[model samples]
Target: MKKKMMVGGLLPALVLSTCGLAGAQPVAMDTLTAMEQNPDAGSQMRASTEPVTQESLQEMRRQLEEQLQQAQELQNRLNAQLGSLEKRMKKVEKKSWEPPVEIHGYGRLRWDKHRYEDRNDPNDYKTIWLNLFTKYRINDRWALHSEHEFENNLTTNHGAYEGQGGYNEPGGKKYSRPVLQLYAEGRVGEVNVKAGRYYLQSPYKFTFDDKIDGWQISYGIPTKWGRKANFTLSAGNTYSKIFYGDKENESNYWNEGGDGNLKVVSLIGEIPVAKNTNLAMHYGKIKRRNDRLERKTWSIGFDTKINRDLKFWAGIAKSDSQTLNKSHFLQLQYKEARPDIPGSYDIYIKKYLQRGHSGMTNWFNDDIAEFTHGDYKEENIANNGNDKVFQYSRWGEFNGLRIGVDFVPTRNTKLLINYTFGKMGKCLDKDPGRRYDYSFFRTQWEMYF
Candidate 1:
């Protein structure tokens, strides 16, 4: 008998196939002879089996080892590709952050007129006021913010006593440039810090309270309900030094311990009420170096909305001159939900009141006199060229009433019309049983950029 072996294919699997076997159909004698011959490598004679060969076993083992090595090489290639992809993803994430510089601003042009019995040189002027804000972010927790304002009476441009009866020499069309806010803001742990020149917050908002030039510290915590509980404290200048007479002082800022400056400090806090509503409480005291309230004031109020259309706002402030102060505001407004939608429209009506003895507080962003409290109106309203008696106000001292309308015809423009009527509770010193009523109308076109 003879033994036959197969070495037709180099691959392990195909080397064991029997599809090309030599005997397909044989005669009886031939079949007997084939059965008698040793079967091909994948088969054996029925009566006996061929012994395994050491050399054939070694070849099979070698092929298996080669296949293992190829699989490992393929796996290494896949891992290398995966590592490169991960590195690229990390780099892209680092580049995708908020912009480092920002700019925004708002401007308004107003045609304001005040008329009363026997008024000379009608108090009418179309004034343009613009404010621009910019910010540069240094990092995740630090930034520099700067804001400036410009005002043009469209007739003359100079720094004059801007209050009542103020004067600007009629000359060229120029604007007054004033820096409103410039500050470096950052955070250390949970505490927020601000330094440089910025408006000192007085309760809700006070313009004449004077800008502070010092440092501030603040903090806030956010709740799951989307409201933040916040507190702020600030220190800066109020009224500065005194340089009176032969006392060798060049200014009249009392309690300036040789620094020729005065210090004012303020503390304010806010508490969340509900969705889109909150209460703010604030206290501010201007101290002489001797530690007395040179100009002290406080404010606490609630500003909220109902059904997203109607709003109720009320607040009060008290100072040495503004005692028993009070204020109230209510408005019904309808505006487009967002800027992109085409059907954008806004119309609103508002009512405001401030009355009582020294009943006054300052509302910044408001140029209307009836809404102003204390001396801010007394000084500025007269400059509108109105009768001194006509300046009677419900401002922090007298009783006042205001009605205003705001309408938006376009996405970026708004028109505002407001009227204020006021009367003092007591008689004017110059006149007996004074019954002078004060009122004015202002029309404004406002835009944002």
Candidate 2:
């Protein structure tokens, strides 16, 4: 009887141990002692007890070993997963500390046909331009940008006036070498600043295509109406031969001109006058070192959006010079060409009445104001000149109409076609007979990366 009781107790203890190993509640030591000391407790368990054998004990031991092995395998897998997650987190932290850089630009191919009333044959030429732009972000508050341009003329003969004297070469003008265009730009608080070689767009003093060597500062004005307003000041020397002098001269540097050092200062302001409309004003002063000729220029204009897809702009510019002192323009545009959207297009019409002195440099669209050397002549009224006939070459007087269409066939690709027809004459010429009729046509294709 004693042996049977002992086996019964041992069997219960083994069952409890197995349950504990399988993550169940463990039997307390006091409960085990009570079961052993109390006769009633023994009697309660006696009916449920079974005979204990060596085979049964071996089977329980084997099950416990297998459970322990599974738990160890699970712990190993969890440890490996944690290690992989830690590695990915370290990689993300490294990337957050590095600076960012970007590179992009565009290439253009253009064909031009120019016809003057006095010339017997039209001049046709083709040009190719490649521009490279780079940007580096030093931090959230500061960054740097640079642009380089390469221009090449593909037409060798250049039509009838092939050997005529011109700016770069007698046969044809070409810029085969790369030239640095824009250098740096940054922002400080509410002010934006630019340095090195850059371009400006103003009514009288500068156009969008004119390159200048200098610096610029601009600030935005806060308004209660949530309208846009800004003030800009720029001072620089002309860096291209297109600015008021011999077109053939290699004056692609600072303060380089045919006459002497040429410098310019310009101030511009835009104030919101109405919904989707703004009043624009500009003041510019240009001075030449050798001749001491100082020209003061100013303009007032307004631009407005007639509707969602239509816009209009008109402005008048005046100069203090005796000749070429007045100019005005009106423009209307329908739709807009978006480079990122395929099948996008725009159409525009512009009317211009410009005097030579009114624009210190050529207009942004060269086809609108085509200037030919020795084509228009005026009597020397200044009296300081040695020649009796003053040959006007740069931005000579012209009144014209220009119409253009810009289309995008695919993303980052654009096609442009424009035509200009007008009458051009000597600067400040009052005689209507001296004016000659002219026409210009141009087509351009561009691709961006």
Candidate 3:
């Protein structure tokens, strides 16, 4: 009875395990048919279709065992692989990299030479100028910028100097000097404030500020057209180191130190005329104050791109100086793109009219001041024969003309050639009679990276 009970339970358990509860119980129809066919058949025979054979049962059990073992092994292998992958992912996620900071600067150098046929002097000179710039970004909202420049040139026959190579001779009209610029600037919403020493120049316009060093505040407000427009209002002071006067408190008519303190104010704008085309306008005033003279100057200018191949620019300015009397300027410029080459060429011309006051003309220095003064000015305070030299060159009025061309080969290289023509209404030299006419041509080549 014990063996029989064990057999019955094992058969049902195997069936249930292989299929489900339904497979554990065969239908009564099969049992009844089996019983009808063989009434003596025992419960063992009725439990299933045929008799249970030891080898067949053993083979089925072996297959089931093998499959279970394989499933467990596969699960273990997958878990190991998953753990390794998780470790690799953690390592990758922990790695970090930093952004790099870079510093760069550029300048220009040239070998300038000229051969003049006049007097067979064959004057030759070399020119070289170096400018360095540095920019640093503290963050998205803060930046620092600065530039320093040093330049030198050889000068000869520059008429401004008399008696070749004197101790105080304008130093060949070339000298090395430090131009310092340091500023902190960033955009505050739509307005920007820049404070500290900076170089300022008007675009589409020219201002006395171009020659002076000062600080400025610029605001860049947005316009309604989705285009960017900004106006710059600036004030700065400029003065020449070459001051002339016998005494600090004394003022002279022909001296430079009396009122050379240059002050300037400007309003300039950058506006878009079209997609790739822009318009610029500038209006500004420069004032000079000193013991002897105070001057007021105004300038207005316009610059625009007419098309892809053409550009137009024009400006007019007027000045009233205590020492210079009255001065005026007119300028016109045009640029045409050369389609055949990679470089562009441009040309500009300017005409100037200036009335120099009597005491403002520079004709004699300390050595000749005693002797040449009488010949240079209408009345020499020192009473010297230099007044006679002034009779031929000083016209009481001076006019000048400048014409120039610029060629740009790339973003970093440029070539400029300019000619300045000057005329004096008053004569200080006998050879030119009562009028003086002369021209100076200068060529500059620049490169940077």
Instruction: Provide the overall lDDT of each model, using Cα atoms, as 2-decimal numbers.
Output: 0.54, 0.67, 0.49
Say which candidate scores most in lDDT: 2
TM-score of each: 0.61, 0.67, 0.53
Which ranges in model 1 have alpha carbons more than 4 Å from their true place?
A: 1-97, 116-121, 159-177, 206-210, 238-262, 288-293, 320-365, 370-398, 424-435
Stretches > 4 Å off in candidate 2: 1-99, 157-177, 203-209, 240-260, 363-365, 369-395, 428-433
In Å, residue 359's CA in model 2 sits off its true spot by 1.1
What order do you get sorting by lDDT, best first?
A: 2, 1, 3
Deviation (Å) of 125 in candidate 1: 2.3
RMSD of each: 12.2, 11.3, 15.9
Candidate 2 per-residue C-alpha lDDT over 1-449 given as tens digits, one digit per residue, 9 for 90 to 100: 77667766775676556545535323333343454456355554455555334565456555645655675677699999999999888767646864367889999999988888877888787878788888787666666777787665676533222223344563222322244565577788889988877777784233323667789999988775587589989888863333334232234311222342668788889888887888888887766655555667788998899999999999888777554567788999999999999999999998988665566555324545432332333456555765476544333567889999999999999999999989876434333236778788999999999
Error of 1 at 336 (Å): 7.1
